[model samples]
Target: MRTRRLIIGVIIALIVIIGAGFAFGALHKTKTNAKTVTLGIMPGGKQEDAIWKVVKANAKKSYGIDLQFVNFTDGDQPNKALASHDIDLNAFQHYAYLKSWNQSNHGDLVAIGDTIITPIHLYSTQYKSVDALPDGATIAIPNDLTNESRALHVLKNAGLITLNSSQGLQATVKDVKSNPKHLVIKEVDASQGPRTLPSVAAAVINYNFAQSAKIPASDSIFVEPFNADSHQWVNIIVANKKDRNKQIYKDIVSAYNSENVKATIEKEYPDGGEKAAWDLKF
Candidate 1:
């Protein structure tokens, strides 16, 4: 009887240990397989759509991370979504735009990685070159402060007009100190730039919008210089300052700046539309 009782107690002890081991294994698996991360992106170009597909696959294969992309139509929504915690990350807007946004909204967004530099271009259907534009020609520029200043700089660089040096990146048409050709500057919504080309002699259009309108880079009368000096305009991957250093966010940045994605950007945007900012350090 004593032997039988000891055998029964040993069997019960073994069963409990086995059950506990299975429970721990299940819990560990649950912890490892969390929900996919959602990223916000501006909707427009095929390049962005293609890049997101590659990122999703690479993230899953390389780091066991699943990624989902949510497209925001306008410039304002992406930052707003990120700030409200509606999205995990956003890959749009340059450093200047981000700085302006932070200043206006009191937001704490920070760039974790550099993505690309989409050169803002002066496009025209009627004029072939900046010098070809006639006197009193109406030139359309983005109405937004950041892009208006950038357009003015491009005009100044192209020798079409001059801006007040002190006005800097905050420059508007009012800041234009001189117009050599007496060029009539029209401030329109950035999206309207390409559309206004038929009405105006020329328009300064952001690259993404130009690409969306199927405007060839060769058609640009003037293109912004892609160099260290223009680094402020390089688009970036952004997150809330508090979450900037998270390991998962770093993994996403790594996937974006991966060699494969870089290759894709090189092949797709070979023209002056958008160049990958691979050399930029975060």
Candidate 2:
């Protein structure tokens, strides 16, 4: 009887331990499954939606991450959303744009992953070519600092204007030391560049905006070079400085930098509008 009692006690203890182990595992699994993240993106056209679906599905299947997207129509909102903790990450702006935003807002957002490079182009509906631009002709550029500087660079490269080299990426219309064409560079909201085309002789437009406006790649008079330096304009997945190294964020980056996503980008924007930043190092 003593031996039987001892056996029963041992069995009861083993059962309790096993039950606790199972419950603990279940709790851990629930915690792991609950992991999710929200990313902000500028609302591109249908292509953007399709690509996001692919990303979302991929992340869900591979990492069990519940990836969510918050779309912003305004170029300025994504970073602001991220800064305010409204979104966990944003995959919209390039390094130059992000840098300018941080400096202006006194924010500490950092890029955790590189995504793509959308070449900025000079598009004109009135003038078929750069040479056709007349003296004192109006040209619209992005109002934001980084893009305004970039637009000036594009204009400088096109020989329509020249900029102070020392100003570099910070160059503005004021840095235009020479405008032989007497071009009137108008600063407008970046999203307004394509819309302003009807009123201006030409406009330096970001690829996404141009695409959104249904502007064709062939309509561009000048396309920014896709080289080493141009990689600085590659769009990135930005996170708050403190969250930069989290494993979930790293997984998100890995998911974005995958071949499936790269292939989708190439397929969606085959006209050189959006080039995947596959070569970019994180």
Candidate 3:
């Protein structure tokens, strides 16, 4: 009985020491210094780079926190890097895209605050106006669910097509209840839509894809309207769920939504006087 009791006490002491060591190490690491935050963005384009410049400058001014900007060449790359901890946050996607990614990937990425929506645009190679297109005109739209529906919505709003009332934002060609123009709609990958423009009558392209392909926003035939209802679809700064409320997160959002940032976005992705890339709702 005495031997068993002594062994049990030793084991208990050993476990306590191990637990205390882990606690101390964690505390020490956390206290070492303010962490540098890395922000992931889409590869440098005139519009996005201009906006990030404002954000980086503001973050430095507001919190004395260093914002390191990393660039990804595609839509999915930022999220992938964030999941791997190669980046601490990202600011290139909107809530709709972010939500779809989270649902499909079964990941816990969350938007910390809203940015702006780079408006989906319909650009044409053969015509300057939506009504001038001839019958059987070939129009291109993003093949993915999120952007495909947004393109279809633009068509519906233009009175070129009618979608089933129940179809909502996920509507596809099959959901088109009316196609008065007999438009031949082709679904291409989002990034490829702009390149397809020279071949098709028009292509409904995402803003990032358009910018990357050097398609000017001022040259597009149509753009999505910026309104409060579109706020959820506007671009956002996102972070892992664990880091949503950290000081760095607030600083990032603050930097992106500042007046300086707003003016830059306007010059970058403007429609009328509004910055179509972000709603400025935050």
Candidate 4:
């Protein structure tokens, strides 16, 4: 009986020592020291980088989190890295994209917080507007499962196509109920949408790709509108399911949504290109 009580006392002491940082840092809602977290993101966006500049700096100052970043060139890599514990967090994909990824991989990743949504828009070089496109004209859109669905929904909202009502967020060309002009949609990699603009009548381009191609907002023919139902499009901070409730992740979210970070986002996309998702109600 004495040995068992001694073992129990030792376990309690160990718990206290392990939890000491959390107890002392409870006021800040983060560990009191410089705990490192590896974040994965796709490189090359000015706005995202600017926002993160603020997030990274402030995370260290306010929460003692040393935010390190790993830039992934491939669109499919960030989540894969997060799943394998190669990364602590990722801030590239939206909720719908994450959901599809989870379903396809049978993985258990969860969004810890909302980030920003850099919306996709239709851009054209030959045509001035969606109404000006010639009949049976070719349109280019993202070929991936999540973005293809999103691009189709954008076209449907622009009155160029009618999608099957039951298709929900993953609509495809086959789900188009009507295509009155017989327009041909060329499915290309998401990054190639802007490059296809000079050839196709119009291309549905993700905001990041358009920015990368230096296509200004004025060059777009149609912009996708946001609504209460557009929650799926909002970008998110993601982590392994086991880490979803970690206080450090919560601190990171708070850091990202701080006033300074939000102001940086507003300054970067002042023309309404990409807005912070903190205040957006789903």
Best by TM-score: 1
Q: Residue-pair clashes per candidate, as listed? A: 0, 0, 6, 0
lDDT of 2 by residue, 69-154 (tens): 99899988999999999999999888888887899899999999888887889998877889999999999999987788788888
- After superposing candidate 1, which stretches have Cα over 4 Å from the reference? 1-9, 12-16, 29-36, 280-282
The lowest-lDDT stretch of 10 consecutive residues in candidate 2 is 223-232
TM-score for each model: 0.84, 0.79, 0.74, 0.79
Model 3: lDDT equals: 0.79
Write candidate 1's Cα lDDT for 107-205 as tens digits.
999999988887888998888898899999999999988888888888887888877878666788898899879999999999988888889999999
Cα miss at 9, model 1 (Å)?
6.9
Q: 21 in model 4: Cα distance from truth in Å?
A: 19
Give candidate 3 misplaced runs (Cα > 4 Å): 1-35, 84-86, 189-200, 208-219, 227-232, 268-282
Task: Tell how far residue 120 is off in model 3, in angstroms.
Answer: 2.3
Which whole-number lDDT from 0 to 100 does residue 161 have in model 3?
A: 89
Give, for candidate 1, the lowest lDDT window spanning 10 residues.
273-282
Order of the predicted models by lDDT, top scorer first = 4, 2, 1, 3
Candidate 4, residue 11: Cα displacement in angstroms equals: 35
lDDT values of the candidates? 0.85, 0.86, 0.79, 0.87
